[model samples]
Each structure stands twice: as C-alpha cells, then as structure tokens.
Target: MPALEITDLTRLYRRKGGEDFEALAGVDLTVPEGEVHGLLGPNGAGKTTLCKIISTVLLPTSGTVRVLGHDVVTDTHAVKLALGVVFGGEKGLYERLTARQNLDFWAGAYGLSRRRRRARVGELLERVGLDGRADERAGSFSRGMKQRLHLARGLVSDPGVLILDEPTVGMDPVAARDFRALVHELRDGGTTILLTTHDMAEAAALSDRVSLIDRGRLELTESPGTIGDLVSAYERVDARGVPDHVRDRIAALDGVVSVREDQGSLVRVETEQPDATLAVLRTLVDSGVRDVARSRPDLEEVYLHLVGRRGMGVDR
Candidate 1:
C-alpha cells in the first residue's frame, strides 16, 4: 500500500508587508510501505513545508494529500494517529519529566491503555538507549540524549508511518551512528519512514530513495543506487597508490576541483569534467597506480550539481 501521496501540493504565505511568498510550488510525491524515503534540500528548499502539510500542522494553499488512504483535509485526526513526526533540532522535551515519563505522556495522548503504554514505553526506551536514563529529567541530558528521546516519543504510539525531519542534525558522532542504526532497525521491522536531512552522509545512509527539492519545486527523485536514479552524474576518480609527483600533476588538471583521501590511501576526486578526468586516469597506467574506478554518481555529487546551478555557482 502507498503510505503517503501528494498531488499538486502547494503552500504560499502572504506576508504582512503585502508580498506573496510561495513556499511550495506544486509538489508531487509518493512513498510506498516499509522504506526510508528522504526529503532533502538546502535551507530554503521547502522540504519542511511539504512535511508540515502532510502532518496537518499547516494547511496547504492548494493540493491533495492522503496519508494511509485518508484525505489529510478530511481525516486529520485519523491521519495523526497513524503517523509519527520528528522535527529537526531542539524541540523541547518536558524537562522535568524522565525519558520514560515523556513516553508515558504521549502514549496517554494516543489513548493506549495503562498496561500497554508501560510495555511499549519500556521497549522504546531500551531501543533508544534511554533505559539507563529513563528516570533522568530531560533538562540534564546531553544533546544526543534528547534526540533519542525525541525518536522514542514518536514511536510510543507505534504509528505505521514515521516522519523524521533531520533526525540526526546535532548529534555527536557516536550518537548519530546509533540513531541511524535505530532507523535502519525500524525499516527492517516494516515501518515506513519519510525523512529529511541537511547532512549528506545522513541522507545517503538512511534513504532508500531521495527527492531533491530546490526552490519549492521537485528537482529530482530517485533511489540512492542507480546513476540513472539521480538527476546528474559526477566525475569520480579513485587515485590508488599515487606517487607525489603524479598526484600533483593530477590535482593540477583543469577540471579537478577537490580530492578526498579515504583510509589515507585511495582518493575520490571531484571534477568539473569527467572526460578530462578519465583522460588523466589513462596516463597513469604505467606509473604503478594499479587500481582506478569511477562512480556513476551519488547524492553529494547531485547536491553540488543542482546547488551549483541554483546557488549562484556555490557548490553544496
């Protein structure tokens, strides 16, 4: 079953100063069951606008959205019960309450029974590493701790669909890793997730398919795999076992822009022109550089490709 669908979705704001600012410019999207679909864009790309409309917190200027087969405009209460939403960053927890108590509060709001709520709360807290901190008030917890509690609160109701907006935004490295693993575990257990993120690593890691929104329009939507799945391809060159002289020569090539060393060995090169990059690779065949490979493309590349055009030539 399709967990969510949007057709001709749009939202526009009329400022008090008397100008019209369109936040969404006709978005069309679908999310199937049991997968992680990423809604990714830069700061003002309108991903949050789309999510708010689906979650029914903000009404659309014009569009149709159905969550779990119920029209958002008509069946808002039902949709709320069937879905969970996690927004990015510092959404306050009831600082006086313990992690377990926060879950308890949401569970009561969701109308779960006393026994069932306790059971579910325990399970969720354990899953999110808050079992140890269940009794601690939210105000004293670290940033990472708060993020976990936010996720656990969303799952307290056991909603069929999850909306996670930048779930790992401000977490420490270890915390971020743990949170992503939790997301993967949920997907494995048949929870459909619609998520957004500014972190390229986070988006690439969690997204089964990703929609790139730019300037309030659907720039592209496709799976994380398949070069054809994304809107553009980036030049990737794996420079293996390069001597210093050759490395400098390759770096000085016209199209080469940046180089990232992996494990201090192989380097991934970002280039302006792939054809020229390949030509550079061809010349190093006799220089003991045995391994060379190129990717069709990835989100980081697509981000730059689109953001470059849209961002006054500033690559993402």
Candidate 2:
C-alpha cells in the first residue's frame, strides 16, 4: 500500500495588492511503503508549500492528501499520529532547553509514558550522536547539531511516515554521510520517508526515485539516472589536433550528434550514446589525436538543462 498519496493537490495564495496565485496546480504524487521518495526543485518550485500541506501545518486550497489511509483534513488527529516531520530551519527546538529536556518535552507531547519517554530520549540522543552533550542548551548548539536534534525530535514519536524538508542543509560532510546512512537504516526497517532537497547529489544518491518539481508542478518523476537521461544529453568529448575531415567523420558516425571546434586546436564531439565514446576516441586516435577526454551529464546538468533555461525565477 502507498504510505502517502496526493491527488490534484492545489494551493492558492492571495496577494494584498495583486491577483491570487496558485502555488500548486493540480499536482499528484504517491510514495510507497518503505520508500525514500525525493521531491527536488529549485527555490519557488512549491516544494515547501507541498510539504507544509502534507504535514498538516497548512491547509490546501483544494484537492486531497492522505497519509497511511488517513485523510489529512478529516482525520487530522489520526494523520498526525502517523506522521513525523523535520523541516530544516532554526526555530523548532526551544532555545533555552537542554537537548535532553527538549526531547523530553516533545515526548511528553506525543503522550509517551514517563518510562517510555526516558528510553526513547536516550535512544534518540545516541542515534543522533548527541548523547555526549545531551545536557547542553540547544541555543548553544551549532547549526549542524541543531539539525541533528531536529531529526531526533521528529522520530521521537516513532511515527511510521517521516516528512523531511531540506533535512541536511546545514550538515557537515561527515554528519551528512552519517545522516544518509541513518535514512537507509530507517528505510530498511520499513519507515517511509518523503524528502525535499535542493542538493542534486543528495537527491541522486539517497532517493529511490525523485519527482522533479518546476513551477509548482511535477515535471518528471523517475529515478535519478532516468532524470539525467531525460535531457537529450550527450557525452562531451574534447580532443586536440583533429583534422576538419575527422571532425566531419566523427559527426557522421552513428550516435555522434554534433561536433564543433574549440579554442587552441581542440575539437568538441557530442554523442547520444555513451557506449560509442570508445569508438569516437579510436577514430580520433587514428586521426593522430594528441589528447582526448570524455564527460557525461549528471543530475545537476539535467536540472539546469530543464529548469534553469526555462527562465523560472528563484524562490518567490
């Protein structure tokens, strides 16, 4: 069964001196049980708005959303019982409270028994690598540490579904790696996660599949590799000392899309097929090529090719 489902979800915002605007325009998406589904887009793509509506922090203007069979609007209590949320920003935890105290407070709110709360708090502190400093006031913690606490607090309820928005924005490299591993662990244990992120590498590496959102709509939903392949990307081959005839010859080869001359005697070859890279290199070699290199498109390039060139402005 799908852990989370959204159908024709639309949200409209009214402006004080301007016309009403649609943040989400009839968007539809589903995340299966135990899957880490990523929502990716540049700022102003409605990623945050969608997440807020899903977590019940904001109401949608239209459409429906369900979490584990519970309607977010009609069954708000039941949906909240099954949902855990971690939105990347600085304000969730009470600044004056100790890390342990903060977790204790949230656990109490979840209605965990006193004994159960203690155990859960201990487990989460260790899990988030903050046990050593559990007594420190949260206001004294660094950005990354606070982010970790945000994660721990979300899971304090032991909810089945996790909604994480830009969860690793402030994490250091080491912390980021550990967090990714923790996400994998959660997925393996049957926890469903909906992650929103701008980091292309993070989305590419951690997501089972990604929904690429642009202008408040899903432009594509596929695996990272598939998204990268969606753009008509070519294997870029840079070679030096190639004759004009050789350039034409390379362009005429099967899978070779285009060829152009670069500064300082360099020839650029574009090919649709990656497997044909070796063949192109061989041809260049036969033509007495001096140097050659190959580069391929990744998720970042794909995003730029699709969204950036479309002239969509950054977050509104």
Candidate 3:
C-alpha cells in the first residue's frame, strides 16, 4: 500500500462576516512506501493545511486521506500509531523538561511501557545526536538543538511514515546539513517521508519526487531531475554593453521568452531553444559585445516561474 493517499481533499474555513475561504481544493496526492516526497508551495498555499489534515490534527471538510492504508477519518488510532509528525521551530518542546524527560513523556503517550520508554528515549537521543546533552533542559537548547529534540520526539513511536513541515527553517548551515543526513538515514531504514519546505535546494537535495501546489491547487508533480530538465529546455544569456538595436533584435528572435535589462547595462535574454540561445549569442558577439555568457535556470527559477512571486509568507 502507498504510505499516504489523499484524494479530492478540501478544507473550508468560515470567516467572521467575510467570504468563506477554501484552503484546499480537491487536492489529490499519493506517496509510496519508503519515498521522500517534497511538497513545495508559496505561503498560504495549503501546504500546512494538508499536513495538519494528514496528521489528524484538523479534519478535512471533504474527501479522504489514508496513511499506511488506514483512513485518517475512520482509523485515527491506527494512523497515529503509524505516523510521526515534526513541525519546524522550537515551540513544541517543554521548556522545563530535560531532553530525556521530554522524549520519555512522548514515548509514554504512545503507550510504551516504562522500561521500553527508557530504552527508546536513549536510542532516539543517540540517533538525533542529542545523547551528550540528554539531561539539558529543553529551554536551554539552541534552535538547532531544539529542532533535534523535536525530531527525537517525533520518532518516539518509531512510526513508518514521517511528515516534516519545514523541519530546517531556522537551522544553521551545518545543522541543516546534519539534519538532512539524518533524513537520508531514516529513508535508508525504510521510513516514508513527506517533507514540506520553501527551500528549493533542500527539496531538490532530499526528495525522490516533488509536488508543487499553488493557490489551493496542485500544479504538477515530478522528480527533481525531471523538474530540472523542464527548466533546462530554456537557456539564459546575459550580456553587457549591448546597443538598444541589438537588444531589440535579440528580443524578436524566435523562441526568445523574454529580454530584460538588469542593473546598469546588463541585458538578460531567456530563450526556449538552443538555436535561439546561439542566435542571441551570435548577435551579441557580432555586435562587438564581448562580455556575454549563457547558462541554464535552476529549480528556484522554475518555482518562481511556475508559482510567481507573491504571498510568500507563513501559511494561515
């Protein structure tokens, strides 16, 4: 069975004296076992709403969600038993409790016996690199440390499917790298993961496949390399000291997507075909423009092209 199955899922929020908002509109997604699926969307794009519904923290207004073959609505207990959820930031940990104590509490909540909880807590602390500071109060931990603790808490149940909602939001570069390595370890051990994040590099680095959501709808789902290939179909050429006539000529070339001026005298020409890019370069080089270069777009550029640059903030 797929690790997660979401079909025609929708959520509506009734506003006070305002029009009711539909956060998710008939979204459908399926994640297979042992795959790391990345969810990417702008702020207010229903990513968080989807995560909450899958975790059973919020009910969907319509449609069905299943985790590990257990329907979220009809089998909450089984879903909970099979899932682990970790949201980004340091807000979920108990301030006064030591790392060991916090993990112990969460394990107990999952019905682990006292002896089992002790063993599981220690195992988790070591797994997340918190064993050295297992006795430190959670409040005394740094943001990275707290995030590690959060991950440990999420694994207290040894769930099969894990959902990480921006799990590296405020982490330093080093910490983020370590966290990603840990995720790789989890996936290697046969854990299925659903990761939502605004970081394009992170999504590209860790995901086996990725789904893009926009304005309460899913736009596309593809492997990261496939997405890269989509953008690779287009090429960009940047040149300096190009005359207005050359710029206009490049703009009129076939397959040229756009020609825009950057800061100062630099002009960027985006083209949809290799011939177009070559033509652009030939035109510039023939015009005595010696400072021209060609390159391909990355995942971030594709995201901005697909989703546009607007409403990029925390989801409501």
Query: Would you list the C-alpha lDDT of every candidate in the order shown?
Result: 0.80, 0.87, 0.89
> lDDT by residue for model 3 over 1-316, one digit each (tens)?
9999999999999999988899999999999999999998777888889999999999999999999999999999999999999987789988999999999999999999999999999999998889999999999999988998999898999899999998998788887898999999999999999999987779889999999987788889999898656666778999999999999999999989889998988898888776898899899999999999888765455555676645335446
**Model 3 segments more than 4 A misplaced:** 234-242, 261-268, 273-300, 307-316
Q: What is the clash count for each candidate, in the order shown?
A: 0, 0, 0
TM value for model 3:
0.86
Which has the better TM-score: candidate 1, or candidate 3?
3
Q: What is the lDDT for 22 in model 2?
A: 80
Query: Candidate 1 vs candidate 2: which has greater TM-score?
Result: 2
Give per-residue CA lDDT, model 2, range 1-316, as digits (tens).
Answer: 6899999999999989998888899999999989899999878889999999988989999999999989999999998889999998877999999999999999998889999999999999999999999999999999999999999999999889999999998899999998999999998999999999977778778889999998789887899788656544557789888888888888888887668786978888867676667789999888888699888755444555666555445646
Write the number of the candidate with greater lDDT, choosing between 1 and 3: 3
Q: Could you give candidate 1's per-residue lDDT for residues 1-316 as a string of tens digits?
A: 6999889998888888877888888999989989899887877778888888888899988989998897888999999999898887867589888888888998998999999999999999999888998998888888888998999888888888999987887788988888889889889999989999866557777889888887788877877664233333356778678777777777787777666687888877766675667766775676768788866545545666665544333211
Root-mean-square deviation of Cα positions for candidate 1 versus the true structure, in angstroms: 6.1
Query: Estimated TM-score per prediction?
Result: 0.79, 0.81, 0.86
- The alpha-carbon deviation from the true structure for residue 124 of candidate 2, after best TM-score superposition, in angstroms, is 0.4
Candidate 2 error regions (>4 Å): 228-301
Better candidate by lDDT, 2 or 3: 3
Question: Can you give the lDDT of residue 32 in candidate 1?
Answer: 90
